[model samples]
Target: MNSLPKRIAKEIERLMKEPVPGIQAVPHDDNLRYFDVSIEGPTQSPFEGGNFKLELFLPEEYPMAPPKVRFLNKIYHPNIDKLGRICLDILKDKWSPALQIRTGNFVILREKVLLSIQALLSAPNPDDPLANDVAQHWKENEPDAILTGKDIVRFSVSEKMDLGIRQAKVD
Candidate 1:
């Protein structure tokens, strides 16, 4: 990896000094541009009580280009595919060079990628989904789909434990 950009370095430092609630993003020692992330499922959501693992990588063109982010663990959500590709607008055409990893109080909450993803878990948009089947399920039988999502999280957590994969801990 090349040297970290000044903007990214400052963002990383702020992330460490003033951590976001229920979210953690730690850069790997070998690659500062890559982060190992964990987001605790939002309260009152189907994903509640689950800790989701994800990977985020700031590409060479970073703020001008949105960071690449995807779930490392399986999650049953309409907007998230089996491969963990997210269908969030900010990660796509809405991306802007002015966007920051963490935003100030006045900024629109969804403008922050990580916060948007966390909010996605709380309010999934089945109408515009990345996983067609999951979206169909969500649209057809909403209650059942929610149950399935909760079950998938429980199963994934157990599987992680069986494999000795440590869950990320936020301070």
Candidate 2:
């Protein structure tokens, strides 16, 4: 693998030193720009108690362009599509080169990508949604939609656990 950019290397080092709560991002041995991320669902949300796996890739453009992040596991969210594409402003037009990965009670209110994604899970926006059907479900019957999300979270977690066990046995 080629050497990582200085900026990316610093960011990764900082991330390792001062880790964010409820979020873990580890780089691949071969590719430092690619991260295997896992975020625990926020409490009081439908996805609570679930560990959502996601992949984050820092492109050549890097801070000039937003990192590409998408869920690797199933998630029932209005802002998230079937393909795990997230409909978040920061990931798109709102992206800024100055954005960092810090979270919680910072002096500046600058947006942090992963933290913003976690916040989105806590407060979903049905009006602007990637998953039209899920958004409609949220708009029409929010309670039912939340219940469905909870069900999906439960199932997804269990399925992941089972897969882990099987892999462990194989190993």
Candidate 3:
């Protein structure tokens, strides 16, 4: 069996060499099991042009256990809490020993990690959410998520809005 550190190192090396588009991973100078990743918001999504930071920690059991990832940036999203916790199935209830830290053309890597993150951006999982207010806002305001992408651009441009402004603030 591959030791946890070795497995994590290999995964980090792979991510560094051939990073997923919009996502880059870098290891800490003294921590091999922990890595810093930056994921660009998917194009045409609420996070478009927004850069988000994530901290990934591969535990002692690695492949047998899912890596823990927490948002390091303050992102106001339905699936992410104010404290930066992410509510994703793979990181929680759906984690499996088969999944690994990769975003290449493979089930464990691509499908489980990158695809899921994209899906989260496309459709926040309000049913199981870490941020209650964000979820409620998303559920109540039928078109918020789709409209949110444009809002980011608008906020940067003029910071003026006639409507949907209340929904933007998760408070």
Best by TM-score: 2
- Worst lDDT run of 10 residues, candidate 1, spans 102-111
lDDT of candidate 1 over 29-135, digit per residue (tens): 99988889899999999999899999998899876788899998889999999898999998999987666523453232222688999999999999999999999
Model 2 Cα lDDT, one tens digit per residue, 1-171: 338777777778777777788988888888888889889999999999999889999999987898999998888999999998999998999987756634532211111688888999999999999999999999999999999999999998788799999999999
Per-candidate Cα lDDT values, in order, are 0.84, 0.85, 0.68
For model 2, the stretches where C-alpha displacement exceeds 4 angstroms are 101-111, 161-171
> RMSD in angstroms, all models?
4.9, 3.6, 8.0
What's the C-alpha lDDT at position 87 in model 2?
96
> How do the predictions measure up, each by TM-score?
0.86, 0.88, 0.74
lDDT of 3: 0.68
- By TM-score, the candidates rank as 2, 1, 3
Better of 1 and 2 by lDDT: 2
Q: Which TM-score value belongs to model 1?
A: 0.86
